[model samples]
Target: MRFCVSLFWLLSISSLYGQTAREIVQAADSKMRGNTSQAQITIQTIRATWSREMTVKTWMKGTDLALILLQSPAKDKGIVYLKRKKEVWNWMPSLEKIIKLPPSMMSQSWMGTDFTNDDLVKESSVVNDYDHSIVGDTIIDDRNCYIIQMLPKPEAAVVWGKLLVCIDKKDFLELHTRFYDEDGSLVNTMNASDIKTMDGRLIPTRFEMIPAGKPNQKTVMVYKAVMFNRPLDDAFFTTEKMKILND
Candidate 1:
């Protein structure tokens, strides 16, 4: 009788310590995006033959609103991209025109980089649009991580068939993510590193995206500065604001 009681207690304790996969994903997602965020970033595109870099400032309000303004590189400076809910638009200062992006263009590269338009705009929410499951645990960069598998819901308009996300157990930081196509083929991989304290939060400051079958091609984004939970108005995300962004 005592043995059975002890076993039951052990099982109960184990259950108490376990967390649902969705909860784990939500915790990690929440850390990356607060109520509002402003940051300066440098994007580097590296290829076998040539490479280029661009600096930009980004403002994000929740998951639905974002604005990116190119800051450096004389040719691309003053360009702005605004994402409001489901709509996306790009304002080209050189052409003096605003171009609306269609749904079909979401998968295209953003500014000739490995990151797609959907990635920069964050059109889909991983926690809400996908069913998450913790497949296993692994170590990355000497940090313990949870290997999570996310499958998109039938109604979710997402491009990736499956996503394998590696989140550090210590701080709930997303260390790596592998994206797969509908055919179960690898599309690309994104790895995060260079963890440091930014905006009073410890997070990864560098992200690298490498395409499948292209070992020599990749894009890296390094965060120079970040401020979270800053006050930002909804009007700042509008197309009208995109045109007048000077910095």
Candidate 2:
């Protein structure tokens, strides 16, 4: 009886010293404390036997909202994905039309990655869509991290039902994440590695996503030319400039 009591006290004490895992998960969704920034994007995707690359000029006021224009590989140039508030639109250069992305499309294939189009452009806030509760604390990549599980709020319009995210204790960078479907089946796993410098920020240099059911299947993305807080003219986000890249 004494041993059991001692163990309980030890557990209670540990909780007092540890940060809730949910806080780490929220770090990924939290908005930056500043205004917009322009970033030069370099994205390379590979899945199974297929490989492709794309370049984009992106502008984001916050992590959850952005205007991204595709520029690369000689074919998919001028394609724009814009997220404003709760709505997301995609402009196809071939069709010269803007179409609103349906929630169902968010789960569909995104380029070659296991992530859906929704995953590629995460312009929605986790705070607004889901409730985060810290399950426990864990060590990820030798850094103390919080392992938070996020369950979608009933009123939230997002698709994913749950996500387990591991966040760094110091920098709050997302080290790893796991996604699940509404039925609670494991769907995909995402990891970021190879830290690099761009625009003076030490962000994830490589992003990899692997589907749960597929064997030997994974998508890798390398981010380069990451400029931070660069001044961009308002004209850059206009349809006129988008058309030039399309032409």
Candidate 3:
């Protein structure tokens, strides 16, 4: 009788810990994206032969709306990408055209960088699209972290088969993430570092995405400045607004 009682207690504790892991994921994701945010960012693509950088201003509202306007690289200036709901549109100032990105193109690299269109638009939410579990604990960048596993739901319309994420236990910040393919092969890894106070919140100031097996190639995004929960009109997320906003 005592053996059976201990087993039941162990199982109950395991179930409760799983719930806590999911909550931790939710909290980390919320810290990265508030109700509304605006920021200046720079993306740098490093390669063996050459490297390039682009600066942009971004505005995001919840999980459904986002806008990015390229500000530097005279040739690529004035380009805009807008995300509204599940659709994403691109405005090319040179071509004088607005192109709607199709579902098939969601996996393509954005602006010739390691980040895909889905990454920028965030078509799926980690908290809602995956089952979370606490795998173990590790230290990353001197911060003790909870290693969490995220398995995609059967009906989730996402490309990643699984994700291994490390969240700082103290502040619930994502310190690193490894993405796997449908075949369960590691495809890419993202590391968040250089933590500091930005816009009144403590977070990672830089993120680096490195493709598996490519030691010399990577993409880095650095946050210049950010403001969370700012007042932003819904109309700012429309395609028309994307074309008109030259700044």
Candidate 4:
């Protein structure tokens, strides 16, 4: 009887640990992405000799739909990227063409930045496409955090082979993330900072992506303005909306 009780206890603890990891990931994802979100964002790409900055307007609804419209620099204006369900498309006003992005293109550089198309448009969901497990815990930026490791599901169309995320305990903010390639080599590191309240919620407004072995090269994204849980229509993510610059 004693042996059976101990075995049962061990199994129960194992199950609890697994459930807790998923719950933590779910909560953190929900905090960052509300039901609907609209934001004005600026992306700055820096290199050893040259630097470029661009502004964009973004709208996202749940995990199924996202639309991003370029808004600045005069030359790149009216460019748009839209992700609906599993499909991704890009609209180029200069060429008057809409290009459909394939799954293989998710790993390519996004606008010559350190971030990939998958990173910006979120083609694969971290909460749903990957299996989460708590590897350990640590302190980051003077805040206690839970270190979670994510492995992509077999059927999910994603670029990263592995992802390790450090999420703060108090606010569930994803403070740091390391992305790895299929060969187990580090590809990039993403750090989040400048937490502030926006739309009645606290979130990281500044994000930086640094590629491995790329000295003095990084991409910085800043959220200038953010609104969450706003009403958005399904038609907004269609290809027709991607060509409309005024809306």
Candidate 5:
């Protein structure tokens, strides 16, 4: 009986120690490591009678960094979204001007899309902005998942309190997410679906976000085109390219 008791204790310790800090970091790396060269982004709102689709040429090195050039639908051509660290900038074609987006406006609607400006552009946040933890094992969209809780390191920078992410076991592609308020109340829920092959990578091609307490209000994104892991030149990520693409 003494040997049986020792075996149980040993197994328990192994489980706890197995999920170490390094392992946690590795999981984060898996979650956001890759390149997306070009993508088609469409934003549709359920609460209103509106939708907009745009082709995007983009590049990224890590979370909280990278740039985007928007093309298509004529009027919105030559629009660029650039973010490095805390700063955000946009170049518009109609006026031929570069506009600086204030920090507070990040949460506002993104050019008439159902989602906010923040939602239209997804910047990887698990590393620099949030504290992460593996809450448990769960299933999402019939695939095994790792439930991770991400809370903003500084409460002031973001609008949500706690963010829950369901990462698909096979690939770290995020399957679902829920953003909570400071009081721990859920404020929004987003789901990834209609998965398809984009730029040789199989990913969820459709994204939907629904505001809590507002069932009629929801946002859906349908990818018309996506070229994953494509090589994009940094020189193309400029105000000049923004105008050229729009033109």
Candidate 6:
């Protein structure tokens, strides 16, 4: 009888921990992605020899729709990338053509930056595609954080083999994340800083993405302005609208 009681207690504890980890992740996600959002962002790519920069405007609704418009650099100006549901499309104003990105290209770099196409477009659902567990705890930027381990579901179409995400306990902000490849090798690290209130909500306004084994190369994205719940509809994410979107 004692053995049965102990077994039940252990199982209950395990279930409670699992629920807590998932809830933490969900709250952090909501903080980042509201019902609708718009932002002006600047991206800087730094290398040992040279650096490049570009500015963009972005709109997002829910988890399935997003549109990014390049606003600077004479050559790439007026270019747009749209994500509708699971499909991603690129519109080049110079060429007057729209290209649909294949699933194979999702793992490639986006616009010569350290971030992958999946990182920017976010076709994979972090909340649904992976199983979450609270591995431990850590301190990031002097903030206490919950270190959660995320492993992809066997049938989910995801690029990372495992992920260690450090979400701050006080505000549930994702302060740091480590992405590992299928071979269990650390592929990239993303760090968030510069916390400020944007559109009445606190958030990290700067993000740095650094690839493994490339100490001299990294990409930084800074959010210049942000607004949440800005009255967006599905029509705004269509291919036709992508071609015409401007600053």
Which number leads on TM-score? 6
The candidate with the higher lDDT, 2 or 4, is 4
Writing each residue's lDDT as its tens digit, candidate 1 over 13-63 gives 655434477788888887878889999999999999999999999999998
Clashing pairs in 1: none
Model 2 / residue 140 / CA error / Å: 2.4
- Give the per-residue lDDT digits (tens) of candidate 2, residues 42-136: 67666567777788776766654577788886687778887666677788878978888877777788655566777767744565677776666
Q: Compared with the true structure, what per-residue lDDT tens digits does model 4 show for residues 1-108?
A: 999999999899878877787888888888878999999999999999999999999999999999999988889999999999889999999999999999999999
In terms of TM-score, how similar is model 4 to the real structure? 0.96
Of candidates 5 and 1, the better by lDDT: 1
Name the better of 3 and 6 by TM-score: 6
Q: Can you write out model 5's per-residue Cα lDDT over 112-181, one digit (the tens) per residue?
A: 6556666544533445567666677798778897887777776447756788888776766787889887
Candidate 6, residues 24-142, lDDT tens digits: the string is 99899989889999999999999999999999999999999999999988788999999988899999898999999998888899999999999998988889889999999999889
Q: TM-score winner between 1 and 4, please give it.
A: 4
Better of 1 and 4 by lDDT: 4
Off by over 4 Å in 1: 1-19
lDDT of each: 0.90, 0.70, 0.91, 0.92, 0.66, 0.92
Q: What is the TM-score of each candidate against the true structure?
A: 0.91, 0.81, 0.95, 0.96, 0.77, 0.97
Candidate 5 all-Cα RMSD: 4.4
The regions of model 3 sitting more than 4 angstroms off are 1-4
lDDT of 4 at 46: 100
